[model samples]
Target chain A: MRLQFILSEIGIGLRRNLSMTISVILVTFVSLTFVGAAILTQGQIQKFKGEWYDKVEITVYLCPRDSTVPSCADGEATQEHINQIEQVLESPEVSPEIREVMFESKDDAWVAFERNFSDRWWFTEMSVDDMNASFRIKLTDPEEYQVINEVLTGRAGVEEVRDQREIYEPLFDVLTKATLVASGLAGVMLLAAVLLITTTIRLSALSRRRETGIMRLVGASTLFIQLPFMLEGAIAATVGALLACVALWGGVHYLVEGWLGQNMDWIPYVTTGDVLMVAPWLIIVAILLAAISSIVTLSRYTKV
Target chain B: MIRFDNVTKVYARGARPALNDLTVEIERGEFVFLVGASGSGKSTFLRLTLREEKATSGRVLVAGQDLTALSNWKVPAMRRKIGAVFQDFRLLPNKTVFENVAFALQVIGKPKHHILTTVPETLDMVGLAGKEKRRPHELSGGEQQRVAIARAFVNRPDILLCDEPTGNLDPTTSLGIMRLLDRINRTGTTVVMATHDDEIVDQMRKRVIELQTGELVRDQSRGVYGSSR
Candidate 1:
């Protein structure tokens, strides 16, 4: 009847069955850790996609000035060919698709290449005249890059078209699949945890059969007899969830971000700040998982 | 008052009935001793009054409610009006003596103030006021049984069904318990004790019902414990 009395009984029940209580907590913590890992990994993948998608451009490298191809027969990109490409980019139909465009001359391309590969010997072999100038186009729709590529390629001065999305797709695919695998494993573990929790509660009930029988004989309601067992499970689950959130937070912050940040700075936005941003969600998920499993197990097994 | 009309109870998958075509009546404030050896339907009769086991083919009425027609959910409410003492004492071992007696009132959702007053009063009534802090295991056999009596009488139930309340005590201790039951009976609580202590039954000279092989052989007021002595 009193909240304090009920809670005290729950505490006693948990203490009396310490091993089973710890088992429930550990099971919940492990399952929720997997769940938290899956969620964080999915968030990281999304963050990478958003940052890379924003900076990614369609780079159309033109024929070289000293080439022997039909596009470069004039020994350089002709003014008339440049005018035609600019006209197509400025057109109302194409303007809506192309958000912004920038041109790189041969000298600019050589300078960029030199800056990128300054430590390598390959860059010393290429002169300014050997470099191919290109137009970098930022598209309005990342998914519609194929339409822009079709319109640009085979034009007078364009030699090749490349979309960066195709280059990094396999990596994102693997991360996404890893998320699915984690979630599948978590689902199975959670189900097992529920069954184990139920068994634990049933065992607790059996151990205190005399107390329960006495309670029933004295006119204690079924709910009154059952609440302590339910509280036992819920408390264990909640403790487990709390443990999981801490474990996941440390795993993401100290291990993944700490090790990976030092090795890979080229990839932007893979930071602990982002992981901490979703830490509250992990805690909520842990508590919810514990609460749900507790309710389900107690309702089924501890019916006084 | 309690009444059983041709009450018959056959346990699951059992050919013979535990109580066969039995009829009995107990008036309010009456002290009745149900005497029989083991498996003689003494326990079955007490269980039927508490609605723990139902009669198979007859009507059982306790305090004006038909045990057969009452829903399972209403059994607890019905039991609240009756007190039961078990042979094992059934005191919650983890609880202190005070808590064990207080639990009887607490379970029924009695107000905190009422419990604060009534638990001590009931403990005092059972002569267990000074030992309220001790657990059941710390007490002697008779003392533990006294605590159970306190728990039973705490709510002031209209009827008390005790299945071998003195089964575990020595004869001298058994007489003390019998005197306590008699004191409770004088307060208008119908006391039904199922026991085989021939000495107390003969000494009290109360109404006795004898059963043999699940059949009532004798029913008499002021009956001796057994016919032999």
Candidate 2:
């Protein structure tokens, strides 16, 4: 009976302030969506960094025929120059840091160049002599790339030493900054949401002051008078949170997994699963928002 | 039972105390009217009796419990054993008469079965049985006051504190309300009412306590309401 009475009171309170309730729902939804989006974006960047970083390799571009590069000024690398570089890469001291070193000959480089630049007529006109024979060194640990770079670059046959991770760092930085901005906005919006919830509850309580006063006169406890108002806020915020979850699920399922994944298949994107992972936190935040607002405002309005 | 021992309630610092150096007692089943002009501390007497305002320098006891010493949380349980009514008939405008009475029981954690049986019985006792489905705004002023009284009395409290329960009613309605109070008093429930109704007090001929400037000027057992007038 107590539960039923409180539930009915909650319903009445919500209905009495319908517009305020909707605004509360919208505010909560937008704030929690940002929070969910920020978390998922961070998770996505980590997944990309973990998966792509493992496959990142250091490319030791070797001297090519007719090359004018200073590192290759010794002229087209002979078999001895190639053997010297290969031996240095395969030596026991360097081998411990290197996972697997695969050699790319002039012919193999030419094949890749033709496939990539076949649409450009001026590029396909040249022979395989312009292609550099390179040693692709996969590292045991991506963080130890500088160790291999120090050993390989500036050698007689080496033209350049490049860690593949550097090429992706700028992209990761942009994504990380985007998530940070989103998190900052989420923080501001969450504060606004809390304040809005608090104001809405205070207004609702003030509008029903007569009811509460009578409730007190009839010997109603403080909790009894305040429960209905607290539940009103919780209901609004929980609905907002659920709506946020739905928005996040749609964005991940359609935007990230569908369009972005289809366009850039190699880049791992966040999925609906990621949204689901963050769903509980969003709801918990929503409930906390309501509870905090209630705790701050209810005592003054509903106190016996 | 209600007792006030040297009670002084000062709402603001360095201001006139609402009740000053007061000591009074009403037995378990007595019907007493607290009478005075505005600011004579008549309302303060009722407020202190219900512990709505703590006395600044003395003890106010109700139903054998010292309200001045009662903790905040215990006020609810203590209030449960006492019922209060107001001059304006403070009923929820949206709720029906039956719901208004049932709400009193519901807030006290009474069982559904008990509320179901007792609410209508109490409404019937207050002469609003057939009007249970009517809202407060839909009822007449007298009927609205009946709903408030039914709500106050539904819990079968040890004491009924009516603070001008008929203050908004006409003379005939006020007489009816007084008769209803007399009936409730006969049920062995102590009743303390504060009113400016000189006619009702003189006609009822019950004990009357008159206050002037926060001081008890008269405490007359079965006396008229004219000693301090």
Candidate 3:
């Protein structure tokens, strides 16, 4: 048969079963929406991790009253203590790993505290001498955070060492779990959609049993007789997938990235570009799912 | 040619057989009429040749292939050599007359060149060439049956199996369809038609096979419709 003839028959079948076609489209749309959402979330998580890791800092707070070692023996961290910390950071052995080192004195810490909580009544009794001075070191390779933490934790004037990886890991954990859950739900719904598509095709075939029987008796091949129904299902699925892409784009733009970017710029990674970057993938997934389900259903149910 | 050698078809768990241990032969270029009232196995006899139903125990052959032993994949190939015109006319309601006739050739993998030439020629033979663009609903009863016959003969099969081809038409339209089938048979295509119409059977004076309750009661050449009694 000619390609035009086959396509025309498919067109007619879709038109005749309009309601069933719409149902298939709607089911595909909802299923692919979840799939797109999961993908976008995964992309967002990766983007956030990359951006945050680049700026991650390991802060070492020096002991306040020890004054036993070199600069610290002169009471509090003297200029010599600051110089010793700076020497270790500028040493040739570790110089390549340390990009820049920042120093904070007790007075600077006190000033930052007052700046942050000047209006709060609880900070009125706080003083500059009560705070501990610290050093914030930025590394050339964020993955070498463990090496820096080990090197500085037991130093002469060091009080405590902390890496931001400890905090980011928990946030990533929650985001990853959410992505998996959404993907799992989408998978289940996709399976149900395939079954529903199969049933819809079977019913459509049954409704036109007489026509199919005539075609069979006239020596129409199994493929020729089945192509129309399969195409109908595929078209329905494609429509659904397109709708899902649109919904995903709108949801991410106005909802997640929109709200978070406006209020939480300090968090460093919320952006609309992340969701837009995943839009093409969503449409491709929708088309593939619809086509696969239609092919599978036709092969199994319309063989006779 | 079609032949049956001790053909017996029995439905599972049923008391009476659809066709008993019967043997018959239908020659090529012959117009044969199978006659009986309803439920007399006339339909079964037609269906057996089409491979719609197979004999339970004997060799049933059509166009030199044993239908009982033919694989399911080969059934469509066998059907290509045999045209079956159903009582209901089975025209795809959504298609035009041109498309309905073209369907027969398309099913057999005929090229578009052949279809464009052959479909109009066959439709012309059936006297419905001008009604090609009309749908089944747009045509009258006689025109629909003619379209069905045009589709049957479009592929130029060796044999045509028509089950009550004119069962729903008036006398005048029935005669028109019979004349068309007669003209087709004259071109050396064998025809096996099952019918309850007594006048056409007697007028044609063709070979007749009469069935009564799943048994062959009579088989005669140049036979009358009710003469078997």
Candidate 4:
């Protein structure tokens, strides 16, 4: 009987404040959607970081026969100069940091150059002697690039020792910044949701003050008097949270899988699985929003 | 049974007490009238008995429990033993007559089967059986008060406190309500009604406890509305 009465009371309250209830649901839906987006963005950043970091390599470009660099002033890199660089790269002190090393002779370098730029007019102006032979080293740990750079730079017949991270670090930095922006937006929207839920509950309590007074006079406990109002807030917020989950699922299905995934299959993207991981937290946040607002408003307005 | 021992209720410091230092004992099964002019502390007396307001100094006891010392959480249990009616009827405007009377049982956590049997029975006793489906707005003043009275008496409380239950009703309607209260009193539920209806008080000839400026001016058996002056 108590449940029946409380249910009917909840129905009455929701119907009485239909417009405000809708606003509360809409606000909570928007906020929780942002929260899901932030979580998935972070997941995407992690996937890209893991895949690219393992594939990046450092390249040491040796001077050509016509080179003017001081390290190559002795003339074109001879077989002796190339053999000495190879010895240092395979030494026990440096070999562990170097996962794999592939050497390209002047002839090998010329062949790759011709293959890549054959269609350009400048390709006809280039010859095998103008190309620089190089050592390409993939590291076990990309962060230890300084270890290989110190050993190889300014060595005889070497023109420059460069790490490829310089090319990709900026891309990673932009992704990290995007994640931060999404999280910041989620915080602001969550605060708005909290305020809206609190106002809706306070108004509901005020409009039903006469009923509460009568309930109090009939020996109802404080919890009994406040239950219907609390349930009203919970129902609206939970619906918003559930709607957010459905929207996120649809977003990942259509936007990520259908649009982005089809166009760029190699870039590691966040999937619906990532959204599923985030769904529970959005619901928990919605519940906490309702619980806190109910506590704050009912304590003062419906106190027995 | 209700007992007020030197109960002094001061709503604000240095203000005239709503109920001055006064003592009164009401026996079980007795029907009493709490008669006074405006501001004579009749409402405060009922409020203290209900623990709505604690006595500033003295003790107000009901059903052998000292209400002044009752803990806040236990006040609800204390109140269940005493049903309360009001001048305004205090019915939920949106509920039907049956639901309004059933509400009292529901708030106290009664089961569905129990409410179904008791609510209609109580409504029938108060002469509102056939009008169960009507809302408060559809009922006359006396019928609304009957619904309120039925809600109070549904639980078979040991005592019933009515604060001008008939204040807004016509003379004939007020008489009918009084008959119902009399019947409930015959079942051994003590009745304390605060009213200014001189005709009802004079015709009933029950015990009267009159107040003047928050002090007891007269306590007479088989009393009239103006026995002294």
Clashing pairs in 4: none
In model 4, state the lDDT of residue A259: 96
Q: What TM-score would you give candidate 1 relative to the actual structure? A: 0.82
How do the residues A1-304 of candidate 1 rate in per-residue lDDT, one tens digit apiece?
A: 4676678778888988899889888888888888877888888788888899889998887877666666555666766777888898898878898888999888898888888987997767877888888888898888889887878777888777889888889988998999999999889878877777777778888887787788778777778778778778877877887788788768866777777766786675445565566566655665565467657665655443
CAPRI verdict (incorrect, acceptable, medium, high) for model 2:
medium
Q: What does candidate 2's lDDT look like per residue over A165-241, in tens digits?
A: 99998998998998999999999999999999999999999999988887777677888889899999999999999
Please, what are the lDDT tens digits per residue for candidate 3 over residues B185-207?
99999999999999999999999
DockQ, all models: 0.49, 0.69, 0.40, 0.67
User: In DockQ, how does model 3 score against the reference complex?
Assistant: 0.40
lDDT of each model, Cα atoms only? 0.84, 0.89, 0.83, 0.90
Which regions of candidate 1 are displaced past 4 Å?
A65-124, A145-158, A256-302, B3-8, B13-15, B20-25, B53-60, B66-75, B107-113, B133-138, B209-229
User: Best by TM-score, which number?
Assistant: 2
**How much lDDT does candidate 2 score?**
0.89
| lDDT, candidate 3, A1-304, per-residue tens | 5687778777877777888888888888898888887877787788887888877788888777653445344466566667787887787877799887888888898889988998988777877776889998888897788777776666667777788778888888998999999999899988877877877787778777777787778777777788778777777887888888788867867776678767876765534576566667766666676667667766666554
Residue B138, candidate 4: Cα error in Å is 2.6
Top-down TM-score ranking? 2, 4, 1, 3
What digit string (tens of lDDT, one per residue) describes model 2 on residues B11-105? 99999888899999899999999998899998999888887888998888899899988998888889888888889888888788988888889
TM-score of model 2 (first chain only): 0.89
- Candidate 2 residue pairs in clash (backbone atoms < 3 Å): none
